[model samples]
Target: MDVIKDFPIYVAKKIKHETVDDLIRQFKGLQANCYDLMINRVVIPRDKKLKEIEKDGNADWRFHEREVKFIVRTENGSSISVEFGLCKTIKSLKDYLYDVKKVSIDQRQMTFNGQELNDEMILNDCEIINDSVVCMNKKNGMSIDIDINNVIEKFDENTIVSDVIKFRKPSNAENYDLVIDGKIVPRNMTLQEANISQQSKLKFQERNITFRVRLCNGSRIRVDMPPSKSILNLKEHLNTVEKFPVCQQRISFNGKDLTDDLTLHDCGIKDDSDVYLLGRLYGG
Candidate 1:
């Protein structure tokens, strides 16, 4: 009689345990679903749109979201006319290439008006308008001989210092400084701002300092930095390389916290010096 009475309670406890396990599995599945929705459906698209707005300094492009027709020309002289949505990302175009042209994303590299297009960048953000020509080439290591003068041979009065650099240094393009008449030309300065003409001779010099970044995961990353650039610049570079956002990065050296405004030179950070990087924890 006691066993029969206890059997109902025992069954109830077993059911309770199974219910908890099932609930946990369902909760985990829901979390995964939500994460996918947030990242793919919301976050990435929103980021692309925000970048477009920031680039144009207004939301004017949103009103003109029509089909963009452009040419994708391969290095081997083959070409195709692709009509895609203006709001679509370069990644989507790469997907189209994979689907139609059988060009694997890993094997392809693209450039527009002598500037490399990032995967996250939108078509309109790249200034790829109607009839724009996009050059497609096989993914080669950054060994392609680039003649700076030839690259900017068509430079006019409107060309900025950055334009020349981007045209020549397609990879890690930001790390270079333009030197004209033995003076470093400010990146934001135009030819007119620097009192230089299209015929002026210029030099692209990479002014970078190499250092080691130790992450919380016990892995180290080699960072090449311009000594004059601030810690904030380092964080931004890490954001690009490591995909960790600037806001979540906490950096320290010699057991002291480094402020964003402090330059690598200011911190007395030399080549190969170990800088520790930590990710900030959220929600306890």
Candidate 2:
């Protein structure tokens, strides 16, 4: 009987221990449910909202990022990638090159598809796209030194002969021939085309010839002009120097009317040749 009574006490202790264990497990499960509720109610929504914000921010960035990235290939076969806004000018690109490549702005010449790029041209206006390859050449690379009227000037080999002449003497470029090594280079050809190199010495040979112009009053005036000049140029010169109105002037050579577009050479005018100038009569 005593053993039976002790067995009941032992059973009560075991039952109490089992109740505590069940309560502990129930409390842990309640904690987990609360954690899930917190996450679903607040944390998950916040994370989704943050992701949406990040997505929108990226879209906005992409929308405003209007930049063009291109590659510049130098004469030495090296290349570099550059990026700029579409509105940026070519001058800005040159400035960047000067800073990075240590090249002066005047010496750096950029070209796209064989067309020389102007400094004032905008990047977008040049039709440059992303990943386009631009060519960068040093202007001094093929330049030749030229002496004009005792003043030495450097010009590129690709420079047109007429352009060099015009730079030296605007009013008389067409009348001058570029002489190198005792030979006359054609004015219509570039320095490179004329076989002129960096070591070449250039001189200007004036081809001016004196001619007589008979005015409407039958008075003769002596003029020195180049045969390459158009009659329009002559009329303009007369307008400036003699105060003759170009619009009212009419010229005839060899009894035939000379058009303004005809060059003196086209009319076969030579030294001491005489031409008649008459005033245009306008009727109301």
Candidate 1: pairs in clash: none
For residues 113-192, could you state the per-residue lDDT of candidate 1 as single tens digits?
55567789878678777877676655542322223543535443334455556666654456678887688888655445
Candidate 2 wrong stretches, greater than 4 Å: 1-198, 204-206, 281-284
Off by over 4 Å in 1: 1-64, 143-284
Candidate 2 RMSD to the real structure: 28.6
lDDT of 2 by residue, 70-147 (tens): 987765556788987666688988888889867556677776643567899877777777877676666654657766
Error of 1 at 64 (Å): 8.2
RMSD of each candidate relative to the true structure: 20.6, 28.6
How well does each candidate superpose onto the true structure, as a TM-score?
0.31, 0.32
Top candidate by TM-score:
2
